[model samples]
Target: MRIKTLLVALAALVVSSFAVAADYYVDITNRTGYTIYYMYVSPGKSKSWEEDVLGNDVLMNGDTQRVTLTGYTNPYFDIRLVDEDEDSYTFWNVDVSTQDIVVTLDHLD
Candidate 1:
């Protein structure tokens, strides 16, 4: 049964190898009429929003911004959008790993 055990181990190794996480590309779209001052993306497991993903530029109304994030432990991501009036909107546990995600900020009213 040594050969059988070896085959099972090899299979497990191959499966585990495929489990390695990949980078995720996300587009933040502003569907709201207000100008988006900043967009924050952080790992879902983290306690805080790290920083504004839009470094030098602001995501204006009706504008879309592309961001690439790497090395997340889980598939879930947390997003926060800040408007010009300092109003904040939070989206929790967004799944962005498997497919290209468009995080749209829409009018609350």
Candidate 2:
């Protein structure tokens, strides 16, 4: 009976660990001539909020960087890339529910 209890507890612990959410990584590259001021990522179908602003150091030409998010549960995400000239390039309404926990971006401006 003790052995069975131990096995059950071990199984519970393993299942609990899997229940925890995962973190995701996003890589951004600056292909544009201008420097990017900031970027944002937010939850499903909601108006983009400033709180989600990812203050990446001014991304210059051919520069690349990565951002990590933990316990993100949004079905839809929006990315706004802002330039020094106040020009914003918006990648709107992306569904990431099925995407891997790790997200990598290349030259996504």
Candidate 3:
């Protein structure tokens, strides 16, 4: 009986850990006619932007894409966009506790 109880506790712990690492989807929208060259998401500031580009995906205007990230927490989702250096934008602080997040990219031109 004791062993069964211990096993149950262990199983619960494992399940909870996996739940904490839940998956989230973000809608990337490019309002600008120009295509966004790159899109990236990371835990914190990264010097090498290429390394942090999630799945090497680029979002075009009026397009929506979904990417998955592991170990995402609440209150802040780090995301950024770059268009030929001259046009770059980063949303440092995002609240992800909600169901869905809509990111709209405006035209720099």
Candidate 4:
């Protein structure tokens, strides 16, 4: 009877462990009429940008990519989008928690 109770307690603990807050994922849309070769997202208060989230994948014009922001609790972020020609578009202090992102030429840094 003790073993059965222990197993039930363990099962409840396992289920509760997965109930943490969901990570924020923002969809970024490319509207700059250029193919983006790299993308970076960093916390708004940070001095430097983090790793390129796009990796080897490119975001073509009019394409949308979902950026996963894991382990970050801040809602504001600085996003950078680099094109094939190395031109960068930067958006600073963007509220990424509530809305999606749309990158355009007006965002050129």
Lowest lDDT 10-residue stretch of candidate 1 = 100-109
User: Per-residue lDDT for 25 in model 2?
Assistant: 57
Worst 10 residues of 2 by lDDT: 99-108
The global Cα lDDT (0 to 1) of model 3 is 0.59
Error of 4 at 64 (Å): 0.2
Arranged by lDDT, best first:
4, 1, 2, 3
Clashes of each: 0, 0, 0, 0
lDDT per residue (tens digit) for residues 28-51 in model 3: 566655567777766544454434
lDDT of 2 by residue, 1-109 (tens): 9999999999999987775566665566677777777777765567645453555457676787665656865445666777777777666665554442222243344
- Which candidate leads the pack in lDDT? 4
lDDT for model 1 comes to: 0.76
If both were scored by lDDT, which would come out higher, candidate 3 or candidate 4? 4
Off by over 4 Å in 3: 1-19, 44-57, 84-86, 99-109
TM-score for candidate 3, residues paired by index: 0.57
lDDT of 1 at 89: 75
- The predicted structure with the larger lDDT, 1 or 2, is 1
Q: Each candidate's lDDT (Cα)?
A: 0.76, 0.62, 0.59, 0.90
Against the true structure, what is each candidate's TM-score?
Answer: 0.74, 0.59, 0.57, 0.77
lDDT of 4 by residue, 1-109 (tens): 9999999999999987774544778899999999999999998999999999999899999999999887775678889999998999988898888878898998888
**TM-score-based ranking, best first?**
4, 1, 2, 3
